[model samples]
Target: MGAAAAAAGADPPPSEAAATPAREDQQHYVAAATGGVSGESCDAAAPPAGGGGADDAVEPVVIDASAVAGGAGEEEQGECGFCLFMKGGGCKDEFVAWEKCVEEAEAAGPSVDVVELCQDATAALRKCMDAHAAYYEPILRAERAMAADLESFQTEEAASHSAASALASEEGQR
Candidate 1:
């Protein structure tokens, strides 16, 4: 069933997921390098060091993607399940765009970069990710909670198993 579902293109296959970040980056760079994608460079999209690093990452020039001016197709796709933006009523289009960039990056072959390659796609993906910054807090919180829970569960389970073994050994000694 899993293979059938995958063959049907219900979701991205694992091979696409395993592509290196550099390839993903090159796709974005290509988008940025192209002058038509809103005049913003990828360099301007980079996070700073402690001085509004993330928010200041963009020297933003907003492109009119037809969704903002209002569209029917985007309104139907719905929120990202993995993002806190679903709860906050924020832009889900950012994730959709990011996913598209990832797909393109993965599909692309051996694209080496010079300063001259397009960076708009990468910048756009970055901007989309940054815009959904609300997800960061919740995801980070969950990871910490899960880690702590796993540690506690493992310790308690080990102790219980050891105690049972000791009891069995004493009984056998009788």
Candidate 2:
């Protein structure tokens, strides 16, 4: 009968239970979500519903408006007048006149004293024209080429528009 009862999965006797350890060894596995630690397996004794971990309380990043404005102000001041004119923001006509003067100055290729002037300007301009003569020369040449091409394109566009108008008038007469 005892064998039959054991085979039938009868409960162990109270004496056998008393002989076993009071606490069994336990294993816990924790997983992270969104690359952050899971809250559920934090500890056996959990914190209050609204409190504890710094991760639970998120503070939004704030930017100072005055700091942002100051940075923008500096950027604006740093931009050359020619760049502003090219971008269609309109700069002082004196800047365009100064560019023309530079072109004339380059044709003369700077007198010894003017070369010295360029060296002096370098302290304020961040580049010495005489030192970077090759670089600036190519840039000026490219600007002139671009201006000529733009003028040619505009002339061609105007001629095409006039021709189209003439053809339309002739067709209407028919």
Candidate 3:
């Protein structure tokens, strides 16, 4: 039988002649017939395939420093002090002053710069907030800590993703 029939373990097709190749060309013919890389490199512990392992499971990492730094009952502040000020937690009058000034500036003109037009109000609010620093400092610190933790988590996740991509690309090249 022909080499194709031998490799397939079946009779040759009717159109092709049944002729055996010389023994020297048997290895080359078999190698060509079965096209793939083969080696002893697979003896090591194989990496987890297709995310079936617990290590490959995806879970969100939540970092809430507000509960640790600030009082347990206090609300979480995504930004530093704006949420507290807007919610009338402290320095309500100063915040209101600044807000009214900003509104007036907006009402005056669409292009009015609230920062420039309401500089005095903003300064007054800042001074008031500074005077009451002891009340909100812990909350601010907690917010800053949370921000740092989030940034750190994001950076680490990005690094791990890039590493995984590099590994995948290397395997693809092989």
Best by TM-score: 1
| Highest lDDT against the true fold, candidate | 3
Give me the displacement of residue 56 in model 1, in angstroms: 9.8
Per-residue accuracy of model 1 over 89-126 as CA lDDT, tens digit each: 23345445544444455446458332123356445534
**Candidate 1 backbone overlaps, count:** 12
* 1-174: candidate 3 lDDT, tens digit per residue: 776546443211233322443433333333342233222111111111111122322221122334324535434323222332233335656665766676578778878876688878767765654555443343334445666888899999999999999999999999
TM-score of 3: 0.32
Badly placed stretches (over 4 Å) of model 1 are 1-76, 84-135
Backbone steric clashes in candidate 3, count? 0
Runs of candidate 2 exceeding 4 Å displacement: 1-134
Each model's TM-score? 0.32, 0.26, 0.32
Question: Cα lDDT of all candidates, in order?
Answer: 0.37, 0.32, 0.45
Q: Which residue pairs collide in model 2, if any? A: none
Report the lDDT tens digits of candidate 2 across residue range 64-130: 2232235445223223212222212121233333333344455565463333433333232222222
Clashing pairs in 3: none
